[model samples]
Target: MHMISALLFGAPDAHGSRRRADLVQDLLWAHSDPEDAVQHIRVRPHPVGLEAVLLLGGRADGAATAVVALLGRSAAPLSRQGYTALPPGAPVQPPVPSGPGD
Candidate 1:
């Protein structure tokens, strides 16, 4: 099994963050595969709004796909209610060495 993490922002307050976290948990429970794909979930306050993390169990790609779908499905309504998702940063690549052969 693999683990995937998601972060959500823009909750008005701690209560709002907790509520949104609960909604996310419910959605995952109802929609994810095996009915237990969500292994763990958490929410904490952030300066901009709130932060949430979800640990999912499954193949990495599949888990990512599920999260994408879940976010897509919730984005509109959530945005209308003032919640936003924190986009992930691009993966860093190692620098390649270029030198004359000895």
Candidate 2:
């Protein structure tokens, strides 16, 4: 499913990449406003390590960059149809079943 959010995350150590998503979320929430609920979170990957993509309840225009700065890590944007995030070792699920053709 497509998500509306700012994808800004950093690399993780090879040993614990699977759990990095939760860690990134914690850091974001810790620095973000209490009301800006994180609607979506995807644990993807990076050349260096794992990363996270977050769709907040409110506008996430600058949140990604901010997080990058706050965390002192590099950041990148998630395009509408470009980069994708898939958890390591996760099985590729089949696409959602569509309705019968007319």
Candidate 3:
């Protein structure tokens, strides 16, 4: 029997780096990628919701792959050709206006 550590989970930093990292968790709480070395990380808001896209480099010099979070705590790996770098959704639509007259 295997038990996953709870400390490994969290609201990941949508914008951060984990270069040559030993531990990289996908948006989906799937298996922890302790084998591969994480080269890059990109988090963007999609139509479904916000997610993290992990760019991984193989440990023993394998080809790179893009990993995304699915429905739950699980990850789906994709090829570079299949992955799309969509523009991040805007956080705020219209900025609140403040006048000199308090």
lDDT of 1 by residue, 1-102 (tens): 655555555535655666665665565455445444667655555565545566778676666666666666667655665666654332323224368992
Clashes of 2: 0
lDDT of each: 0.57, 0.44, 0.32
**lDDT tens string, model 2, 1-102?**
223333332343577655565555555455444444545655554554445565555455544444344333221222122333333223544224368992
Error of 3 at 73 (Å): 5.9
Misplaced by over 4 Å in model 3 are 1-31, 59-102
TM-score order, best first, reads 1, 2, 3
Q: Taking the candidates one at a time, how many backbone clashes does each contain?
A: 0, 0, 5
| 1-102: candidate 3 lDDT, tens digit per residue | 111111122223344334201223343224335443445444444333233555455542332222212211132231111222222232423223458995
Best by lDDT: 1
